[model samples]
Target chain A: MMIPLESFHLAEPVLAYLDPGTGSIILQAVVGIVLGAVFAIRMFWSRICMTVSGIFGKGGMEKDGEDETEHSG
Target chain B: MRRSTPAERRLPSSFRDPSGFLFQRDGTLFRQVNEVYREDFQRLMRPDGLYDRLVSDRLLVRHEEAPKEFVDPELGFTVIAPERVPFISYPYEWSFSQLKDAALLTLQIQRLAMEHDMSLKDCSAYNIQFLEGRPVLIDTLSLERYEEGKPWVAYRQFCQHFLAPLALMSYQDVRLSQLLRVYIDGVPLDLASKLLPSRTKWKFSLLTHLHLHAGSQKRHADDAATGKSAKARDAKISKFRLTALVDNLQSTVRKLEWKPAGTEWGDYYADTNYDDQSMAKKQELVARLAAKAKPQSVWDLGANNGHFSRIAAEAAGVAAVAFDIDPVAVEKNYRQIQSDQRKDILPLVLDLTNPSPSLGWHHRERDSLAERGPADLVMGLALIHHLAISNNLPFDHLARFFHDVGKSVILEFVPKSDSQVRKLLATREDIFPDYHEEGFEASFGQWFEIEERISIEGSERTLYFLRRKD
Candidate 1:
């Protein structure tokens, strides 16, 4: 899943922040965890399942042709 | 197969991953949030009062949730349409105070996120926009739950995006803020580090925020791609510490103040070529012409301190865009606007010779100055002489350019006989022999119909009201 982020068209003012310089790390970690978990789960689980489903549905004949070509070669 | 429509012609903002792109449907604005963002979206809306609090505080835009159906085939997310902002301005377009306000607003939002055990992953200024003179954060999904001790991931981005440019503008030159236009992902820290003076290293905030920050960035630059993601997950920051950090940033930013210095045309009225009566007559003539035009919107092309812009604004109740090449003049005009709380005028720094052009991805993202539009009426007071004599642009070209910008033009012609034009001509070639009244009328007549001409009592300058023909 994606995190909502704002995009500014032009440059922003260089005013001070409400948070200290050091405290930004905590926020970054929280964001990293949420985004990381979602991406990992999708790539490893749903992606494999989708590939397996596609093979069973349409690619079985293609797989047999490939195996025949390999044996002939 | 579903047939496609013209509504899907434009692309959304290309920076972030999980969040969908912003698109316009039938002139209404909407954002598409992917299923990838669903978990974070749920967390932001579920427990911490983050969404409601920000919306109630006016820190966020209030929106009606969009339906689940897909408008396009490629994207995984559906639309979550939001309210449209009236006029969007860029950082380069903002006055010093406007930018300062935006920075402070971003920090405020970040702090609130921390209080709710959420944190902002990215601190790009583009995510923030001004609504009715106040800065508001637009990117709702940028906030995620804070993890312990992994180091601020968006730290370098914050410094580059907000701190670097601000420091450069504050310490080096105010005009340096334009550097943001060239650096899309904010000014590069290495470049910012180089441009800043040696003395900046001595300042504590500048040292930690810019110099040392640059050093750390350089060291970890490549490591960011492969570094331990899980290490970041285990660390957490306290709420009180976050507030303290906010206080530190506020104080640091507050300390970085810039004093406006005088520039050419900033003190123009005070050091004019005209005597008091002549000045009064000029003002009277300008006011009369402005009233006659009856413009709903006026652009004072070379508005020096906005003296005539005020006349048009006050007389016609028109919204005026007062533009000048001089930041000093624009700064002074901004101060005036702030003092009076005048909602009708916007003063901007613009070099007429080389106006802002279309910049960013595919040269289509941020529009050029001309692309913004043709003002209803345009004024070229004391500007033609500079363009004609100094810049060497022909009177015909000048007239043609003005014709394209405004339907009606109230232009001031300073004759070759005039001291200012003479002084300009004395310095160089007077190829503009057609720079006289006869020549002006002849060249301009091709594009415009001369409506009226009034001469100021004690000055040689003449103001002409011309409506574009054809």
Candidate 2:
């Protein structure tokens, strides 16, 4: 499981002054933990899940719903 | 605090970021890096550093270290001169695509910063500028060294500044982009959440980043109000997670698209009243006037896909701003600029009746259009009737506005006999009895000297070139 930022510790202090917002920090921390755990599980268990699901006649790993886009031509 | 020398004047918008402030000395802009920003500034300026990489990728503005004498002896750590954009445009003034592109650019920079072991200290729409038809980050001091287990500091600002406005524009009315003018720090997420359609909540990205995000802000409002920084500050989001967060935002911005169609003036020229001879003649007349005017900059008020502004742009090495009321028309102009690879023209969405005003702290954070220019020339073709007849504006009001924003104007006066004017009057009673050529000359002549007047060959419309009176 990914560590939530609230409980995560940093050795260095951030130099910027703008508030990152208390709610935003907590929400993103939750999101980050979920996404990281999902990616980790997918990476580690892809083959096992794919084979097991295939044997059961179910769908395997779905494609990552991401496409690359360029900023400047 | 180090005092500005007699020659150095600090720009108002430059005061927010404390790493440095942009000031002008002898009309040339320079960023004065404070002593506290020495390490980050050095890292950026070092060879093969983040600055070099970003500049090479055209993600950020390139700058040169100013002469030693240019640096202030007191508070200035050092000074660097950044390359100037032809024109600076605000997020409120941007087209849907332009704003979307800027959002993507900010995310792109953030991802790249992660790879470089740095983070954007702030994410603001004002920091991004449209340069040569592309959005580039102009603030060189925005990057800070990324600390392990530290969350992205600009996440809230990013959502507010880009995602909120974009979502409202796409899911609601495009004119809702005007909300950027009211909320200068980007649209409030709670407000955005309320205004957005219920259908948008079905979208996973919007649901998390916007709806839930606003809810989170509410949940933590009291904590923030009580100054409970210890709890949030101690919370550490790992670098990997932050990277994932940025990646998701990038995908979200990409998926949010606004197609330019169905707007009133999007396809305006397709069914214009001007026939081939009259259109060509009008073009010739504008070209002749522009050539004689020889302005370095032009503002094409009511510029429809920039057909007339192109004359002035081609005649002189001019930086032209094309202002139109229709978002689709401005989008078409922007897309054309991209496809054509033209750099001189900037297309923006603006309502002439309610132009952008002074905003932010002291009403100086963002400039009004008139404050930004007194453009060398203003080309207002086939636009008088809309302002005069449709909007019920008087000739003197039009003249004074033009005088305030430009040194000269190329105005076209369409007679009441014109079909477009007749169509406008058909809906309402013709209360504008003074809407005649003689009255136009008389009211405008109070502020401007009529330099030239030519009637189109095939139509009854008259074109006048007037220079502002000294």
Candidate 3:
């Protein structure tokens, strides 16, 4: 059974600049930057939540007390 | 200046990392840690306690500072000498359980990092190595000082590198895991999301990690301003949340499951065209041939679920390595061994046609599949047809390759008239005119002496035991 790579290629359909005929370095770089930004935003959104909570403190979206409890037993 | 010999230059686990390469000048193997990675390496070893804990737990390979005189000049980097691993395996070559264990270990390391205010910067499954039956994280520089509330920077990577392939294996089909061989970066999430059943959206982990994760990654991948730089994201996560994330991931990974059953070749021995009498005769012949080899170690190539591998294992308690291309078959075989506490047999995933290649820095660290073999005895039962028809390998070439791996071999031959061979020929052009018993015997005669041949009852296939004299 071949597992398909689904959403990783989602941008393939919408991009008008991804022409295979010409080696357009500028176009490719623009596309890359766009994709990279989206990846970065998703990664940092959780951090943004925590930063907002850090200012207020009482009910932060995340907790960071070093608990060392074995969760796998 | 005299240069190092290629054999001496070979270092284990070096080919996977491309930033710089690893090589050996003397007997000791060393990784020329490049300047590009200098800061990350220092942070991982110093301010972060990842190095110490990983060493203490035996989850990472230990290394020492090396003298300048023992370095390779061609590849520019400061060489830090390290201990070598006994053997190397690729992700596509790992059993389902093996891959699962490695994934858990990676998450465990990530969890461990939270306490020390560090995080795994990359989540490539290739970074993990198996040494002496244990999974050890090989990339020491992957850990970085954790930013508070950065929401696991390697999340999409972790999902791509581990979760997607695993989920596909569990849900769609186990063979899908082989996509790692082609993708190099792990299966893409968009592809996985499409292949998965619609019901997967209900599973929180799958939804969050696979579907929503892929969607978010796609939308924001272009928005560079959205991701906070290291200074901006420092809202320290309470240790409890860190632990919760780890626990949640562990539970999520554990819950994602698959059961192996009913593949064409999976339950082969039981449903084979052979009757009980023929099966017993064949088994007896195989035992006799393998016993004569007096092998200390054996490899059962194309060992579908390992029924014949057990026959060869009776050859004086030797270690038996059972290899199959099918993930489901390998998984089932491994699970059975684990449940039964079978110690002598090691089940692995392998595609005979396109085997594992040496990867990492300079291709020195991990040895390719062929570099690790040439067992005392290799059993290639019911495997010739696939190689002959499916792969279109000639008999002489197969014989020579087998000779390269082992001193003795046991092979099975199925005529063109046989149902199995006919099924294979049906799909493609039947250009193999010399793919019969006569051609097999003649080709193998150049390197081996036929010791015994047994015809499986209730079938047209024949099994041969041959000893390589060359």
Best by TM-score: 2
Name model 1 segments beyond 4 Å from true: A1-73, B1-4, B7-18, B38-70, B73-87, B116-118, B128-153, B224-236, B260-269, B273-297, B314-318
- What Cα-based lDDT does every candidate model obtain? 0.69, 0.85, 0.69
The fraction of correct interface contacts reproduced by each prediction comes to 0.10, 0.63, 0.00
Which candidate number would show the highest DockQ if scored against the true structure? 2
Question: Model 1 residue B109 lDDT?
Answer: 73
Which tens-of-lDDT digit does each residue in B246-343 have in candidate 1? 44555566567665655342354466778999888888878887887888778899997788898887777777888888776776777677667676
Per residue, candidate 2 scores C-alpha lDDT tens digits across B161-277 of 999999999988888899999898889999999999999999988999999999999988889568775688778899888887888888888888776455443455576778899
| Model 3 Cα lDDT, one tens digit per residue, B1-470 | 23557656644554444444567664566667766555446655763366888788777778787765434454445667767654456788877677777788888788778766677766788888666445678766567656544445465567777888888888888888778876776788888999888889998668766776667556544434545322222323344454555555666677666666655534544566567887787788788878878887788999988888888886546768889987777777776775666756777898889877765456644567778876778889888999988998999999998988887888889899988888998878889989878899999999998888777776788888788886
Candidate 1 local accuracy as lDDT? 0.69
> What DockQ does each candidate score versus the true complex, computed on alpha carbons?
0.04, 0.39, 0.03
After superposition, candidate 2 runs with Cα above 4 Å error? A1-11, A38-73, B69-72, B225-228, B260-269
Model 2: DockQ score: 0.39
Instruction: Judging by TM-score, tell me the better candidate of 1 and 2.
Output: 2
Question: By summed lDDT, which 10 consecutive residues of candidate 2 chain B come out lowest?
Answer: B260-269
